[model samples]
Target: MKVRTDAKRDEILEIARGVFLELGYERASMAEISTRVGGSKATLYGYFPSKDALFLAIVNRLAEQYVLPATERLEQSLDEDPRVALQRFGEQFLTFISDAEAVAAYRVVVSEAAHSDIGESFYESGPKRTVESVARYLEGAMDRKHLRRADPAIAAQHLLALLAHGEPWHQYFLRKAPSPTRAQIKRIVERALDVFLNGYKS
Candidate 1:
């Protein structure tokens, strides 16, 4: 099957993402995706050279869908007061975890992480970047006297660990019970900031 150059790579990737979510990393076969996308395994290979390549493409697609939009939301609303910005940040970050793709990716990564470096790489690219972004924001806020002085990176990791509730988000990815509510996320962020500021006030 000849795929036109004009064929929407993103459209294919989105379909592929749903496939990954449903079947996970090892179980998700290329033939399954080929059928869904109206292409043969050969055509799929033309677009993605191997299973790892397909997974990587899907990971990049999910990052665009799940990460970039959330980042934009935070940046666009970042001009508000520090407290409100923090609240918005919590809301936006929570939004990512609530996503099916994000959840599925975490499950896939955690289940396979002990066996595959790919999973580790994915986490580094996605989760690690998020933590660092939050740290950078906190650090900048401190520089401007908007937030109290401290290790912003520590504060950043703290915010996430609280959101995770003592479990690395892998617990949620594993279908753990008692998924949090919006109010819970908001409350935790408020309390985290309170504790963080109390420790940092000079």
Candidate 2:
């Protein structure tokens, strides 16, 4: 058994991310990733076990780096207006998911979902985790009477659905629309929050 370090693991993840972006999920292979990492296939497998595992790790890293902190910021607003915290989260979520590269990655995941488990891996690592984080915040809001008591999971899904709507989201997924401007994103989020809070407020 070869010893592994955080440095080597990070190196593998960076290289794998590049390969996945360039060749996409279906075409990006572990052997190719190993070559780019300047390591033997055995070593790369020792670190990640399989291509799916490597891909999931990359997804997890990206989600944690870009998405988790935004949702976390909501916790600090417990004493403030719930609308403020929800708006911040909605904006951040929309912006992150609408990035060009992020859209491309999602397309790749969706394209390969029927043939591979990458879709499940992606949902578990990224979207599911994010929803759970949001649900926790919503649960807290309900407990404090900042929002009405209800099923936090269902409420979380409804809030995300509202934020994820609009022509920008649909067209971007089709690879035909540009990223939403900051002002556009703010408007969308504000409107979504308005609808959500109105329906959920005690």
Candidate 3:
């Protein structure tokens, strides 16, 4: 017989996220998680066999919750004017970093990647997917003569690097500065596009 969960999976995931964020994939203890969730480790184990299983669930959840939608938005905007397309993309990318919880999750991933294999998979599924999707868009625009000719992957990386030096990375890693005003984001994305397309446009 199929068994329904006696305890809510969402509730466990919610508490588990705090535990993983605070303690990270390596240092977090099941006993501590069980305590936080008001369950014995044995009960927690019934739901999640090991710390790694719980951590992996969080990683997979993050990719599903954040990354896929961001990429889908970009893919759907391929027909927009190149500048408008880029601007929309920039805004979506920026939103991920500016939100406090998303920023926190990213920082946690950065820290954990130094220690675990799961981190590598998470990077592939999320940030790496984002970079690839951006590159494919650049490639498509280049093919359509809407943008410049260049290696899409390299072009995409360059754009991301440019974006990073500005508000998102700064605000993500540095301090609780004010979110970048829309004017600031538009200006940078515009200037970056100008520089890039100037060199690549054929």
**For model 2, what is the C-alpha lDDT against the true structure?**
0.85
lDDT of 2 at 151: 98
lDDT of each: 0.69, 0.85, 0.73
Error of 2 at 199 (Å): 1.3
lDDT digits (tens) for residues 122-175 of candidate 2 = 998788887888888889989999889999999988888888864366777885
What is the number of residue pairs that collide in model 3? 2
Q: lDDT-based ranking, best first?
A: 2, 3, 1
Off by over 4 Å in 1: 1-7, 72-79, 166-171, 174-179
Candidate 3 structure lDDT:
0.73
The alpha-carbon deviation from the true structure for residue 48 of candidate 3, after best TM-score superposition, in angstroms, is: 4.1
What is candidate 3's lDDT per residue for 102-161, written digit by digit as tens?
A: 666666667767777657866776668878988988888888888767889998888777
Cα-based lDDT at residue 18, candidate 2? 91
Winner by lDDT: 2
Candidate 3: regions farther than 4 A off: 1-7, 20-28, 46-53, 176-178, 181-183
Candidate 1 lDDT (Cα, whole model)? 0.69
Name the 10 consecutive residues with the lowest summed lDDT in model 3: 1-10
